[model samples]
Target: MDRRKSLKIIGGSAIGIAGLVLADWKWQLADQLTHKGFFTFNEENLISSIVDTFIPEGLPPKVPSPDAKPLGGLSTGTDKFLYRLFEHCYEKETQDIVKTQLVNLDERSKSEFGKPFYRLPQGDREKLLISFENSEIEDEVNFFKLMKSQTIMGFTTVKEVMENYRGYKVAPGYFKGCVDMPSQA
Candidate 1:
């Protein structure tokens, strides 16, 4: 083959390979997210929303939101991310426990609080959340500690949480040792 023709063929083949690699990577990611072992999208969204709200979304003066940008309110997407991460970290049974407990808690919230767990007014919501925070739910099929820990973990790990609450980044690429961190520090 002529040198120019050979170069063109080689370049084209390289581009094709790159494309395949990218496509495969994306497919794997989607598959992982769409078909987690324990948590379904609905369950995750439900839990994440509760967690975010339980934590609340706001940036203090000179700080930013912890997990995402402060776009007037919270992002449901961050909850999903945290849910996925939690699912990956724990066993299937463990995740199921958390899910079941969350559902139970929602039911309890309805009966005890007289409102949907997520729909209660701010003060009532805060009081209900305080109850959850103070005591772990007991069950043969649930892990209340895991549920509570995961909620806190998901929110606190988010960059927006640090930025908003403490004016910090959860995972800054470079560390600035000299900055005197505040409450979150």
Candidate 2:
């Protein structure tokens, strides 16, 4: 074979290898973005929908608002929180327990309350959510708690919550702690 032809083949091989590597890296990144922990895209969407509904827009200026960014949304804090949830909670069997409890809750709600979680009215949803919050289900080890924690953390950490809802001052340390009041007449 000619030396030029040999060089051409080597160059083509290197380019092909580089392309494959790049493609693989892109695929992995996209996969990680879509699937974090026990939440697939569909499950993530469902959870996001519920979260958005639970903590919808229009908060009074003073209370921290809920996190509205979906799993795929941009937020390093959220991404890290989610990855940890899956690693610490889901891999540790918390996710399985949560899934079972959710399924049981679905059956009970349909039989006793006549509505699926996603189908319930706003008030009913709130009621069920409160009940769920107070129940033994909270004791279970699963991805659910981790997922909830991440959501809450994200919501509270968001800029909107900090500035608009939580009433963050631009500079709060100017005031000294335990100021003495002047004598009043």
Output the number of the TM-score-best candidate: 1
Tens-digit lDDT string for candidate 1 (1-185): 59999999999999999999999999978976777555665465456556656556654354333454442124525566656766687777666667776676677778987766666666775565566666644552234455556666655666655565656854679867899867773
Misplaced by over 4 Å in model 1 are 1-42, 64-73, 136-145, 159-185
Model 2 over residues 1-185: C-alpha lDDT tens digits? 59999999999999999999999999988986777555555344345444544455443443443754332223324444444455465544656654555565456557767866656665765665556666665553333454466667866776655666567877887967899989999
Worst 10-residue lDDT window, candidate 1? 64-73
Candidate 2: list runs displaced more than 4 Å: 1-37, 40-42, 62-90, 136-149, 163-185
lDDT of each: 0.63, 0.58
Evaluate residue 87 in candidate 1 and report its C-alpha lDDT on the 0 to 100 scale.
64
Q: TM-score for each prediction?
A: 0.51, 0.45
RMSD of 2: 11.5
